[model samples]
Target: MIPKESRNELALDTFIKAHPHLLEEMKELSAEDRQQQILWAFEDEAESRGLEAWELALELIAR
Candidate 1:
């Protein structure tokens, strides 16, 4: 997993962890672009969980 300190960073690390096949796909993007995608995905998960984006990111990061 990536050593992440922020929401977007955590999102990317979480995404790649959950989807190993997508790791290769993620590697092709520029860092900024990859983080953007992960941010979107993280937001989606947060919404589904009825929590704010940063809240979930922080919780996940802690674990």
Candidate 2:
């Protein structure tokens, strides 16, 4: 099985790739701000879809 940390990393990567518009939006921010925004957006998206943040990340990786 994948290590938990690695799984989360992969999930985040998959999530980012699936949302190219996020990258575009992030480009307007400083590195730290971009990181924060991405995390917030990720969490918001997961919540909107009725899944826990990590659950949505893993689901994205699965796809």
Candidate 3:
């Protein structure tokens, strides 16, 4: 299963999609690199929201 933090980051897909440059950069990454990037993004967002990494993941899955 993916970590909670990872799920939160994946949720950014909408925002990422809205930014063509970011989307292009994301598309150019290898699958593994992309996954890591997403995970880190989640961590950042979770920190900003004052939510634990796992909490974000649970929230994402619950949706």
Top candidate, metric TM-score: 2
lDDT of 2 by residue, 16-58 (tens): 7888899897897998898788888889999999999989978
- Give the per-residue lDDT of model 1 (tens digit) for 1-63: 544565556655875687676557688899788767767776787899999987777777767
- Collision count of model 3: 1
- Per-residue CA lDDT of model 3 for 16-59, tens digit only, reads 45445654668878988876876677678678989987775566
Model 1 CA deviation exceeding 4 Å by range? 1-12, 21-28
Q: lDDT of all predictions, in order shown? A: 0.72, 0.85, 0.66
Write out the backbone clash pairs for model 1.
none
Cα TM-score of candidate 3: 0.58
lDDT of candidate 1? 0.72
Q: Number of backbone collisions per candidate, in order?
A: 0, 0, 1
Off by over 4 Å in 2: none
lDDT over C-alpha atoms for residue 10 of model 2: 86
